[model samples]
Target: MSPHAPVLLNEVLEALAPQAGDVIIDATFGAGGYTRAILKTGATVIALDRDPTVQPHADAVANDYPQTFRLIRTPFSGLAEAFAQSGEAKLDGVVFDIGVSSMQLDQAERGFSFMRDGPLDMRMSDEGVTAADIVNAWDHGPMAHIFKLYGDERQSGRVATAILRRRVERPFERTLDLAEVVEKALGGRRGAPIHPATRVFQALRIAVNDELGELRAGLEAAEATLAPGGRLAVVTFHSLEDRIVKAFLTERTGNAPGGSRHAPTAVETRKPSFTLTFKGAREAGEAETVGNPRARSAKLRAAVRTDAAPWGRIAA
Candidate 1:
């Protein structure tokens, strides 16, 4: 298995500014790359991952640095409740590394890659419905909609129709089967660098795992869990996820629509919940991108929580 290297590591650590004795949350904890780095600063790390496979990694750290790290097998979207239950009312810093890890994509058994042929099982957490389940069982209209909205694929209707037609003959059971269907529907491109099946696979993975919904929930959880002066750093791998992160940060920092005098609200009730650490998104440097090709599309954004009321508490 290829070791999972945390993308834009220097940028994330600098933005988060982990200090000694600080309590930080590693919201993704794929291979404990960020978690391990945070521990070097003598900070206590509360790491969470939806996949149960991360438990052993957390255990390894606990053995070496007892009481410095705690791993919870749950999605980062539930972070606030998880922290509250653990009696950590707030955190000094929080980091979210979004999207599929190199570990998941490189491992053929996990079935997250279009390049590899394996079972059509793309659930981040094994407990959730598999990709095969969605492709084989979901209504045709919803399937097309997911492809259009989530994948942003132009030929969603044709792709969905083809998938449904083939599944009737034999339920989609493997990654190659679905990839072949998508390739046929889209008409294989000879010279294009990106696979024709890429968008379809992404759409299925997003729908099966509810990635966008979980991201919104995770951002809300981060907002509520961050202490005054706390920092939140998020790394997103695609435009769709980056857009959601950008909007969430903008709203929290009071840069939303109606900031001017002509706005509808009579009184602005709350101060800004956060201040932008970096005005706009930051991308991986050329060196980092060259080292890890996946870092090419990664974007990092960060902000520091401001002391404010009403708006400070994230709404359900």
Candidate 2:
């Protein structure tokens, strides 16, 4: 299997600013690329991944890093509880490389891509309900919503109707079969840069894994777990995920509406929970993008935690 390349490595390291003896969290430890790099800084790493496949990679790293590195086979969404149980007082930094990992897409059996034909099983955690279940069994309304919202496909209704109609005759099982149905519905784009079924497959994977919800929960957990002055760096591959990260940062820093009651609120008073480390979303450099095409859509956002409770009012 080809090795998984961590996107925007330089930027991640820069934003995270790793220091020796610091306890860090590698929230989405795919192939341990980021985890390994962080460990090289002499920082302790608590790696987490929902997929059990990553455990082997983590195990391998543990041999090299010894007690400096540990892996948790659970979603990053449950990070707070996991850290607490691990007896970690606080985190120095947390890194989240969101969206489907290259490892999963490259492995045909994982079925994250239309490029490779495999069983339509896109569940990040192998134990959960697979993409096949969502595609083959969901009602037309929810299926349509998935395509439209998650996939951002304009032809969601038609595509969902096609899948529903076709699956009635025979339940969808393979990646190619579902891709064929979507392609047929899309009428076979002659020279489109991307496959017609790309969006549909993305929608199915997102739905099956509850990726958006996981992202929200993970962000909340990260915020709660971060020590004052600790940094959190998130790299997102899609607009939907980026928006959530952007909103969360904005809200936590009190950069949103209702900042002040007087003086027009020129600057935030209550030291922002996370001072924006970068001016705006940082994209992968040309070299990185050329090396890994998947880095094309990647956006990295970083912030630091403040002493105040940023989510107190919002949560209530």
Candidate 3:
């Protein structure tokens, strides 16, 4: 078997506990791996993905499961709206696999890889502003801010300075071009395990996609759509996303840390909308880590939806 297996597969199965006839949502149905597993448990799956390139996988699942599977061509952030559009009031389970998919990264044309040369496009839906647009057109200050905040790159200002200087000569139109410029700006990787352009690419991808914002919306959407006892499983590939998931689950599950003596607390608080499924996040097993290197960074945090009214909408 290939080591490119799905991350935290068995753990997700354990968390969701999908049963026959249950309606589950594979909120980020990248390769449809999780959806397929859900289908095997006799659960009906509503799989969503913004990337049209994933249509073939969707077609295959729909073909195999026919009446038991549905594919929605939309971002996972729209989970609640899609379910409402389907005339369904509640969901039994919802799983979100956050960050770029293997399908996207494996292809160079998507411009998600720093290792390969490709067009500088990184729009998952192919319908929005691209990474090329940002790198080539964005100002130095904004670009630096994005790299620092979103990518966690320490030398963000320096990189931005380099990008601005280079783009003045010729705007970056290729993935490798921008990567090389960044590498040069950072003074080369030397012996670093990863490429110097990794963080910059990640920041650009996140900014272009508004990933962190979308994650917040998706979490609330899941809260609104799930029925009592419904399961919500989120698998994040990086610290930024994992932090958001952890906080959301914590507050919704009524486990937020209490205020200290110096910080007084408010009198009113909304009832918890979920119950913690476990104490904390779950990591990939050693076997999984070896089988799928991508699983090494994967962290799963799940909760069971409570009967309490869902949280009100917030800015995405």
Candidate 4:
């Protein structure tokens, strides 16, 4: 295995517990790390990724696991369709390592990282709205909202204001240009551990990709596709992604409160389509975090499918 293994590899494998002949899906097949690891266990792996740049890595894995592995060039939200195309009635397991991958962040041309000087194009796939589109074209209110809601940036309004002020002179085209404007707006990092533009950039990427919506759809698709007793494991790198996973599992496992304080009498109970494999989310250990900084924010959540019918759109 490569030294730069996927985050929480052992834990995800343990949760899936793949055996020979088992069929699995690597929903976010970045660099084919998870898919390759699963295939080595003698299981058939179907990997999905929307990013065209991942094709080379997928090809390398395909050659290595010709009989047991395949790649589908679509977002994970389309995993159910991919499975349907596979003609596999029972999906034994599905694993997702969500959020931007290390490969995407490392490439300067990909324009995912604020640290790298590149075009302000953060589209995970070839098509769709780019980061430049969001930053340069979106109005101030929507832009500030995403900065606050997606990135959790405290000075979202201020940052958006700064971008609006600069774009009038010349449209923002490069990562450094936007980063510089954001940094200046936020008072230049203020001796912070992270760059001042980090949050704003994160907000832009998430908005450009509609990451939260995709995650919700993907989780629902996984629920509808997995066979009874099948397993699902998700690894998230930030709170926004982790929260969605946590909430989905909580509701699906029939563990969430039926009604809110204001709607105490309007309770709606549904059969649980899955059961939690663990009580709460799992974090990387001290040793793993030391070796991989990306693992620091990583959280693993696993569940087992039940015989109950999927709740579908009713599940939050």
Which candidate leads in lDDT? 4
Any idea what lDDT model 1 has?
Answer: 0.86
lDDT per prediction?
Answer: 0.86, 0.87, 0.88, 0.89
Task: State which candidate, 2 or 4, has the greater lDDT.
Answer: 4
lDDT of 3 by residue, 74-108 (tens): 88678888888766655899999999987688799
Query: Alpha-carbon error at 158 in model 1, in Å?
Result: 0.6
In candidate 4, which residue ranges exceed 4 Å CA deviation? 1-4, 260-268, 314-316
Candidate 1, residues 1-316, lDDT tens digits: the string is: 3279999998999999998889899999988899988999898898889987677777788898787888887887788877876666559999999999988888788889888989999989988789999899998899999999989999999999998999889999889889989998998867778889999899888888889888888888888778999999999999989999898887778787664566645224457788999899999888988989999999999999887742533322
Q: Write the per-residue lDDT of candidate 2 for residues 1-316, one digit (tens) a residue.
A: 4379999888999999998989999999989999999999999999989898887888889999997888888887788877887777768999999989877988899988888889999989978889898987889999999899999999999998999899889999899999999999998978999899999999988888989888888988888789999999999999989998998888777777765466555335555677788767999888888989999999999998888764632221
What alpha-carbon RMSD in Å does predicted model 3 have with respect to the real structure? 2.0
Candidate 4, residues 134-208: lDDT per residue as tens digits? Answer: 888889999999999999999999999999999999999999989999999999977999999889989888988
Cα TM-score per model = 0.95, 0.94, 0.95, 0.96
Q: Which residue pairs collide, candidate 2?
A: none
Candidates sorted on TM-score, descending: 4, 3, 1, 2
Q: In model 1, where do residues sit more than 4 Å from their true spots?
A: 259-263, 266-268, 310-316
Q: Which scores greater on lDDT, model 1 or model 2?
A: 2
Candidate 4: 10-residue stretch with minimal lDDT: 261-270
Model 2 segments more than 4 A misplaced: 258-271, 312-316
